[model samples]
Target: MIYLQLFLSFFQVGLFSFGGGYAAVPLIQNQIVETHHWLELSQFADLVTIAEMTPGPIAINSATFVGQQVAGLPGAILCTLGCILPSFILVLMLSCLYMKYRSMKAMQGILAGLRPAIVAMIAGAGMSILLLALFQGALSHIRLGNFRVVECMLFLVSLFLLRRYRISPIAVIFGSGIVGTLIYTLLPV
Candidate 1:
């Protein structure tokens, strides 16, 4: 029953979460944390962090982690399958339609319209994560002391490296990780 629930819940996420994994964050949070109570909000945030740091899509990683926590290996497999199936099917169908309609003005216009919505969704997700990281909880519980100065600094430096110096993102990520580790170890808590 738990496995079934996991499958269905993630299936819903896969079905409705458009514009890729970042756009799926809110839906994932709602289904896994709020609706299903499979994980606490803090745990979900931690899952997102781990997911971001790891390879593969954030939504798939999240489903696997939550499923493993809830129901072990079989749960992980089922949840992952559920999360990917809809996208797989939709992409197959959309690709066929796109090939057929590739020259149509209406199709082009629709694609153009979708671009802004996808961007907005991704931006909203980024803002939510930023707020969560900065405040260390929901907005109502926000405290200045909870803000992570080192993280903000790392972000700024990483942005500078990527934009101004044109450094690879993977290098920036590894560099930030090393810097963060050194700061935590050297600074007295």
Candidate 2:
């Protein structure tokens, strides 16, 4: 029963998540965090972090992590399979259709129209993650003192490095970790 539930839950995630990994974050969050109540909000954030840090797609990674957390190894397998099935079928069908209709004006217009919706989904997910990180997932009742000062500074610095110097994101990620650790270590707690 648990395996079935896991499979169906993630199957829905895979079926409806149109834009990509980041765009699926909210959907994944809704299924795993809100609907199932399988994980706390903070844990979901950590799952996102782990998903991002690891290789492969975020939705798949999230399914595996959440499934494992909820119901161990079999759950992970079912969830992973569920998450992959839709995309596999979708890509195959879409590829065939796209090849056939590559020059169609309506097809191109449909594709172009989807771009902004995808961007909105990605931006919404990013903002949610940022707020979660800044407030330590306590977004319901934000107060000035609840903000993590170090995290804000780290965010600013990371943005600066990305925007100003065009540093590789990998370098920026590791650099932020090192700087964050040093700053936290030296600061009075």
Candidate 3:
């Protein structure tokens, strides 16, 4: 019963979560943290962090993580299959429709309309993650003075390197991890 529930919960996530993985963050949160009560907000934030750091889509990674946490290996398989099913089917169907209507003005207009919505969803997700990171996973702790100066500086420097030098994101991520580990390990945070 629990495994089935887990599958359905993530199935809902995969079905309704449009605009890719970043945009799916809130929907995934709603399913796992809010609706199902499978994980608390801080745990959800940690799961998101882990999902982002690992390979593959964030939503799929999150499904696997949550499933493993909830009901172990079998749960992971069910949840992952559930999460992937809708995307697999939808993409197959949509590819056919898209090919058939490749030059239609209506299709172009629909695509144009969707672009802003996707951008808004991604921005919203980014802001929520930023708030959680800055506040240390608790919104109640939010204050002007609570910002981690070193962490914020690290983010800024990483962004600068990526934009200015066109460094690979994977390199920036690994470099940031090493820097953060060294800093936190050496100094008292």
Give the higher-lDDT candidate: 1 or 2: 2
| TM-score for each candidate, following the candidate numbering | 0.90, 0.93, 0.90
Best by TM-score: 2
In model 2, which residue pairs have backbone atoms overlapping below 3 Å?
none
Question: In model 3, where do residues sit more than 4 Å from their true spots?
Answer: none
Evaluate all candidate structures by whole-model CA lDDT and list the values in order. 0.89, 0.90, 0.89
Model 1 residue 10 CA deviation in Å:
1.2
Candidate 1, 1-189: lDDT as tens digits: 998999999999999889999999988988987798888877887899889889999999999998899999999999999999999999999999999999999999999999999899889888888777666776458888888788888888888999999998888878988998999999973
lDDT of the structure predicted as candidate 2: 0.90
- How well is each residue in 1-189 modelled by candidate 3, as lDDT tens digits? 999999998888888778999988988888888888999888988899889999999999999999999999999998899898999999999999999998999999999999999899999989888787666656657888778877787888999999999999999988988999999999998
Task: Name the lDDT value of residue 173 in candidate 2.
Answer: 82
Model 2 TM-score (2 dp): 0.93
Q: If ranked by TM-score, best first, what sequence of candidates would result?
A: 2, 3, 1
